[model samples]
Target: MDQVPGSPQEPQDARGDDGLPGCYRHPDRPTGIRCTRCDRPICPECMVSASVGFQCPDCVRGGSGTGHAPRASVPRTIAGGTIAANPRLITMILMGINIAVFIAMTLDDGRLLGDLVMLGRTPPGYLPEGVAEGQWYRLVTAMFLHQQFAHIAFNMLSLWWLGPPLEAALGRLRFIALYLLAGLGGSALSYLLAAPSQPSLGASGAIFGLLGATAVLLRRLNYDMKPVLILLGLNLAFTFLWPHIAWQAHVGGLIVGAAVAFGMVHAPRDRRTLVQAATCAVALLAIAAVVWVRTLQLVG
Candidate 1:
């Protein structure tokens, strides 16, 4: 009896001289031999003789092969167990607030006051031609003002896209602190750059800080930032082309944001969160000093 190639061996009803199933490797009517490749019982006719022993037809011709191993998936959480571990929700909320304020500024009759308080544009300090000395409170307020729909729309869109990842990395409180500090930093920079009589207002500075934060965090986390760098470049180019644009605020915010992100991402793992927060506090104080000096100058 002879067996066919690639067939599994079964117990022979009639055994050969060696008491084994017949394999096809031999031309004899009966020769019991096991295929070395599959280890299956074969008759002499089915066996494909290899150098060491008989190989199965599938192994001999290489008709079938073992598949490559699949890659493992990445885990969801970091060591800290942060849920979803990204601050997208926080980003949306901040964008919403900015948009709402912009709408209010558009609707309100007291446009100049909105510019002063929401954008920190103190006319007496920077512009010198404004009415009163006691109106320095606008330094903090002016950060929230936007002169046009396009201005707020652009800033909020940037914030919406960039804010969540940073908020997630820094956590909620630190994210908020960095944002406010960045705004103040931008306003201070604008004050420094603007002529004594020019009024400046907008959230672009704060949004620029978010870009800075993104750059620093991505670098520290070993994340790729090709897309973000391109976006930042485009915005900067636009700033240079547009004369009314406040380049000072954007630069200031970027520097402060980078500093804040560095403190957060690179501080000792045990003390990183606290250190990042302190960095924001320091930025705020620096801006506060500017506000204080400007106020005194206005008062005099």
Candidate 2:
């Protein structure tokens, strides 16, 4: 059911065609009841009955037992998402998946890699494969696939270093969204630019996305930007100079990640959820358009 503001107590007559405000916890659900303490809009599920009005989960949790609203600070991340006890949970799961996939690739030889690696369109002699031939899944799988030791090691190390902090700051959901979108951005660009038969795979694009996000977050928090900028510069240099590196992936992921993180952290408090969703939607739509155009080129 669509959540719209107004109940018998909080009737539709009061809303007067105003834009629906999403519940801070569940953005899809619309609600009119604002928390007595934080003033964040809340759905019935997240609303706890206070002495006067409903309180949000955070307020209830932080509030003292005297039925008074919380004086303590709510546990929320920089991006306004609830902080998790284990900040690195998503990162750990992602690393596990990558490691498991790597082990599978090792045990099964290049068979898994052949299927999972990113390919645009197979050459004439090759079997029907790649995105042009309707095997678009290669784009998603490729980011997690790795056949080489050094490749996985570098990416995993980068993930270990960068993933936890971003996860802590952005919260798990936003962090994962940023990571996947960044990887997909990388994959899409690689597909668009690389030759059809040019097989590529790695989490470097995702890593680079995190790198870009780290820089953005650092700058947003008023931290020194020189370290990340210098690191980005060095990586860019290596990407161009090194053989077998798909620089397109790095560039694409960085752009998308930084853009998404910007929206996540910088959205106006009143419109944070909508703005964040819109930002991700825009990035996805852009990638989809790129994929469509490239598909036409490859098949035509």
Candidate 3:
């Protein structure tokens, strides 16, 4: 098959019958340009513009040893070296735990209307003994137990409403710490003030703590405090007017929550963690001191 040199080559059309080249990724779509890196025809939708020229999606994404540089990392929520996609994850988990505990309590007790209440005074059940008898765990457990549907409902609603924002404002660790400390403060005050024989249980103390923290933080931001003040007043009134309500717990939680929030908002940026830790420690110590004094008085 000998051929003459410089013979005319057959003319070939780069475009298809539609007068444009079919896209490499989408055979139905037509494109006039090709990827600079891979030289693959791509439609506008599949094209990613590079500094020098355009690139196909595959080339831009560095597909299959294409040797393109990896893209920058996406933004993520990183708190104290912990990564989470959702900022409100901790708040949701706390809510779920509370609901699960309530369900378990209801199932175990066989009485939906009453029972499962934790009392400050010693009774026939476990962990109900007063602080005087060194039943300290009661302080923590009492915060999770609620008597009536309305009781848990109101408290959980408050938590759901306030928890996410507070959790976001204060990192997960700090938020959880604040919640527990406030609940402990409430229990301690209840133990000190409530009759030694009286019984009490509810998450109202923690909810009140949230409310108090919100008030303090808002005030620190120099926002108007009238709305919070009115809400606080109404809740206080309800606490006093309602029967079997533990006003002592509410007041104690409010005070401690506010104090902790104050420290959190006022601390210097360089020493925030240290100041918050110290503030929490001092608040817990104060509660313990009050309990110790009250226990001594009761024992004497």
Candidate 4:
């Protein structure tokens, strides 16, 4: 009669065909090593068995020996709090250029080049001779100009403080684009809103734009923006409260910066490259339109 399985005395074969002498799970098997946890037959290869059980390689990795679960991989993000990036190089170069220009203008005797470099726009009643003749360069040239040590100091300090992370995030070319466009926006707005009698100078307008851009970009990165907002608010308030300041350029630069950042960061389709290009185009048009209106008013 065939004995039922799990009988107290299952027939023990003294010699197995494999020649290990018994089932691998059997105590008598020369290599028998049942998994302590599962009590399953485990050869040397399958046996990690001990207090845990004969743990297979899969069990050791996926099961609960160490209880250290597997981790999901996260995409890399920008490294903040470090100035060792590409933007710092650009900032240093810009600072050097501005300082060089300042020194040259200071040494030029009558502040002649300095005044022109500073984009001290011609007075309303009197345009600089030949101003209408391709002096459009002044609009751009003015961005690099500064009237005094304090002016450049403040602007450069702001640049130093804000430029690194922004440049890292946006790249050197894009950072420069934002600065130039923001500068143009500021200058154009200043011309548009000026007393026509007043002259303007300094890179403060564009620096303000960079600040705005920084705030926008940080926010997009999911940063806690309470501090940034407070800082921006205080600066805006100061711009309005300070009598000598031209709030117009600051306002213009800020708007342009926000627009640029929005386009560069939040554009829906593509990798934001198209959005950046479109942003530049639109900002240029806006600046042009403002300049056109100002020129008409000036010539009229």
Q: Write the per-residue lDDT of candidate 1 for residues 1-300, one digit (tens) a residue.
A: 123444444333545554544444332324445556556554322333333444444444553323332221221111111323344677777777777777776678755543464232344345433312445455556677777777787777777777865665565666777787788787777765565345666777778888988888667544456867998899889888888887888888888877876776566545645665677678778877776676455455
- Which whole-number lDDT from 0 to 100 does residue 55 have in model 1? 44
Q: Could you say which candidate leads in TM-score? A: 2
- The C-alpha lDDT values of all candidates are 0.61, 0.80, 0.68, 0.62
Compute the lDDT for candidate 3.
Answer: 0.68
Q: At residue 6, give the lDDT of candidate 2.
A: 33
**Please, what are the lDDT tens digits per residue for candidate 2 over residues 12-84?**
3222134656676556646666777767776544544444555665665656234444453555565767667
TM-score of 4: 0.67
Better of 2 and 3 by lDDT: 2
What's model 3's TM-score? Answer: 0.68
Model 2: colliding residue pairs: none
> What's the true lDDT of residue 231 in model 2?
95
Q: Order the candidate numbers by lDDT, best to worst.
A: 2, 3, 4, 1
Q: Please provide, for model 4 over 3-120, each residue's C-alpha lDDT reduced to its tens digit, 9 standing for 90 to 100.
A: 2234222444544434533433333434333333334443332233223223433343344334443321221112111222244677777778778877876787735553364232
Q: Best-fitting candidate, measured by lDDT?
A: 2
